[model samples]
Target chain A: MHTFADPLRYASRMAPTKTAVIDGNESIDFAELHRRCRLLAGGLLALGLDKGDRVAILASNGQR
Target chain B: MGVPAAGLVVVPLNTRHAVTELKYALEDSQTKVLLIDRDPGELADCVNHVILIPDAYDAMLSAAQERELGVDVRESDLAGLFYTGGTTGKSRGVMLSHRNLIANAFHYMTTVPQREDDLMLVMAPLFHAAGSNGVIANISGHWEPRSHWPRSIPRSHSI
Candidate 1:
């Protein structure tokens, strides 16, 4: 029953303060990462996106 | 991450491909929204909604309220449509479900092993699966020590 998001979910709850992603100038913890992902999910949902819809990501590295 | 987290499918387009190929992929995949990093130029019109990565993306996130993620998605549901390089012929959208990707992540982590503190550097583009290979294991807290690798890498990578 695992999904790609399961890892993030587990890490955020298990090690909320641990650094999960380190960008160029800053680093974010799992809790912060989880919060952001949730917010981003909310934002997309507010945009009228629905389940099973396709969302394409076109970008170079370090943009996320 | 957000798209799939929201129960939506993500289609990562290869930046190296021609605009025509990209357009073809978008159309073929039936993508509804495009979250891009820079000025989309002609690609702006490809999808119904185009959200700029840093600027508009941040704005959207800032205005966003937390919501339940993956409430309707299942392990077997499609998570992403990875476009092939089309070296032989035309590019194809490879359907990958959430379970498939999770399993793949586990496989990758098992093969190479990863430490909780290891800072991975993605040598390939994020559009490729290789770029996001380390993301799951890192988050999953699987430990495998190479012992001799550097702690930091040049440039930057995002998961």
Candidate 2:
């Protein structure tokens, strides 16, 4: 099965440094965003929490 | 992959809420581990765990590596529950599935004009269906999506 990270990796490899997200004065490149998604994915894995175990996120628009 | 792999159901909480309201949502949702955007002192008294937003969250995701989530996922299994405001002053859980989401994504794309070079400005809050769906569309379409937060959007050549 394909992981959620696939599309992220595809974007990064296809566009590399292309700006993926821009929030007001802040911006994140595709590569950095992919890394962030991966890291987040990793962090969720590290929690020792089961895959389907629910994690609630309450951040505003930018954080997602 | 985060919540998708989770047989664990995820419920996004509303930040603009009172302790009691937040407590009710947590308890009703049966959130065993609570991850908050920021530390809510009041929530600490209710939830067993409270995760601070931004830095702490970024670190979690950044440091997160691919590991087995150890849960069985099925096509018909409930993916998430979207609560809607009701006449009884309570909300109803709208059971949604992975296929429901993926199918809807494909259906919506058929109606919308998506170009590889399109850069979408998502001005809605993440909690809204439109906003959340927009994120999904942007991701699936491989188009650059900008979030309007705090405010302001800049001009771009190719988004």
Candidate 3:
């Protein structure tokens, strides 16, 4: 049983350098991914969106 | 509604579709913002704020050093609007909530031991449950998500 609200954090602290994500041509370590998630979440928040506000992303699934 | 839709309402769109069809969905849903894989100017009839996923999205990620949204989500909030095939000639909207998605995701996670090294490939478009859920679940599990299938897989193997 994991003991954290953000399981991602658990992984990060457990293995910061472990390769976490491999998207076809690129890969990101857990530490790197955590940073990206935070940054993107920040960008979303900067767009004047509140917690429950709807924000639609139409990307076809690469890494955006 | 699934992990991606938790705490938010997502409307999936077909990337292969004509702009006119996309416009109708946008209008019907009153979508505040529309994100597109490509150019949105292909559809001229309707107008709304459009954000095109840029080539630099990855570059931005590489340089990302900030964090914001926490994982806390309410079970009762509206999560997503899944439109059905519309047997009656009009597409129907299926509303899903955060709890619905979280339950499903937890169930899925328990069933599969998605490895930290494994890359989850989303073969379908990013609109449906499989694509959306897989993407977010992969993120939560710390697994890499392959955007393009055969092309991406081979590249990963090479590395």
Candidate 4:
């Protein structure tokens, strides 16, 4: 659908080893990030979250 | 990453907001879940779930299977809701769709492209839309190593 998620959807295959984000002392590669995000989505769904549901995030600008 | 991919709307609350402001956002957005890095305090009572980072969040992800984000999500679907700083009277929620984010990312990339060896240092808090301006270019071309999973990264962390 060419949304913001599209890049991540194909990231694992496009450049898995490429570095995506670097936080203080933490370096995350594409593969791990993608897997985690997908799992996160599922986890939220497992918790009974539905489409169009709202998920709020309140935290500093670190690599969460 | 997950929410937008799965057609859910992500509400990035301003970290600078007070308890009442935070509660108002939660109530107004009808946030079903709250993913926090610090203690939510009373904010925990506002959402259906309060997932603390690096612990409850990791557990939740590991127990669940990978989600199929593209199966139902469309470009026009609302991806995120960025709240204003409230300097202009009442804080408002800026509705941004997948298309909007992707386009913005492309604009950022076109203006300031990231090279293979160039790494982007994220300094802005993600609650601000400008902080996540480089997501598309930063993550679009990466390939997975087909290795272990991560317990720290959020759906929209950094990228």
Candidate 5:
């Protein structure tokens, strides 16, 4: 089954340089967003977090 | 977003809720990690780990390796646990699966005309379902912060 990451993966593949998100003066392309997501996921994994684990994010809307 | 990509369930807490409510939601969901923008006072003890935004959050991302995308996420796997506003009664945790959110995205995109060059202004808090789903619905579109709405809206002549 396709997860939420599919669109990003597909977008990055189709247009890596396409701007995916823009917050204020900063903006990231599809490829960069996908890359950061992977790196963040890897970081979580390195913390021993696995499937079914619960993660909470409390931050305002922004590029970060 | 990264949480679900890693095959973990996300429990987005209402920032406006009181400490009592926050404590209840966290305990009810049994959250493993809490990534907050600031100190949550006594609420910090509710989760196993608390990663502060910007600083600790950035360090966490930079320190670890990249995770392989879509490892073992099933359609039925729980993606998030959204808590109700408790306006009617006690707050309840609304369980949503990967398929559910993806379906919502598809449904939203189908109903709303989204173009490749469209720019979406995110005015609502990302913790809200509508807010988060809005972002997911038009993944291909450029997302601008709400602060830029005043100047950005007029530029989008098509809208």
Candidate 6:
């Protein structure tokens, strides 16, 4: 039953304020990172995108 | 990350590929949405929606509400379509399920147990499977914060 999002949810609950991801000087806490992910997910859904839809992310690894 | 998190399949296009190759991958994958970090040129026309990173990307995130979609995502569901190097012919899309990726992360973690304080620097282009999979493995196992080292590592080190 464990999905990709489960670990973040668990980590956020376990340590919400802990730094979950960092890229250079920018750092996001577990709770904030989880919230942003949800927001991004929501944004994609708002665009009429649903499950099984193809999304291509072209970017280098960074805070963005 | 947002793609799969939204229960959608991701196609990480290799930036190094020629424009024609990029176009072929997009067309073959039937990508609905394309999020590019830079100008995609004629390739943008291939997808239904193309969002330029930073500017349009930030706007999209800001405009949308912060909520999690309630979707039943199965492990067997296709999570990504990774294209292989077209050494013999045109690159082919490799269908990978959520279980496939998760299993890989677990396997990677078992091989290299990550510590919470360890810092992982992603130098490799994420479009490649190894790069993305390594990042996934690190994050899934431990919340090891990423660091961007300005100085490149010596050539003696392969990684």
Query: Whose lDDT is greatest here?
Result: 5
* lDDT string, candidate 5, A1-64, tens digits: 6675666677778788988889889999889988888987887777788688888877788766
Per-candidate Cα lDDT values, in order, are 0.78, 0.59, 0.55, 0.77, 0.79, 0.76
TM-score of each: 0.89, 0.73, 0.68, 0.87, 0.89, 0.87
For model 2, residues B37-140, the per-residue Cα lDDT tens digits are 66576666655556677666656665566543313566566656555543487655566666565445544454577877678898876655566666665765
Error of 2 at B136 (Å): 0.7
Residue A8 lDDT in candidate 6: 62
Off by over 4 Å in 4: B141-159
lDDT of 3 by residue, B50-139 (tens): 555675455444454464434555556666766655557756556766555544555455556676567666786667777666655665
Worst 10 residues of 5 chain B by lDDT: B144-153
Clashing pairs in 3: A21-B144, A22-B144, A24-B152, A38-B67
- Candidate 3 regions with alpha-carbon error over 4 angstroms: A1-15, B1-8, B42-48, B56-67, B71-73, B113-117, B141-159
Candidate 6 docking classification: medium
Question: What tens-digit string does per-residue lDDT give for candidate 4 at B18-79?
Answer: 99899988998889999999999999888899999869887888799988666678889899
Candidate 4: chain B TM-score equals 0.84
Instruction: State the lDDT at B139 in candidate 2.
Output: 65
Q: How high is the lDDT of residue A16 in model 5?
A: 89
Model 6 misplacement above 4 A: B143-159
Of candidates 6 and 5, the better by TM-score: 5
Worst 10-residue lDDT window, candidate 1 chain B: B146-155
TM-score, chain B, each candidate: 0.84, 0.73, 0.64, 0.84, 0.86, 0.86
Q: Which residue pairs show backbone clashes in model 6?
A: none
RMSD of 6: 7.3
Off by over 4 Å in 1: B143-159
The numbered model that scores best in DockQ is 1
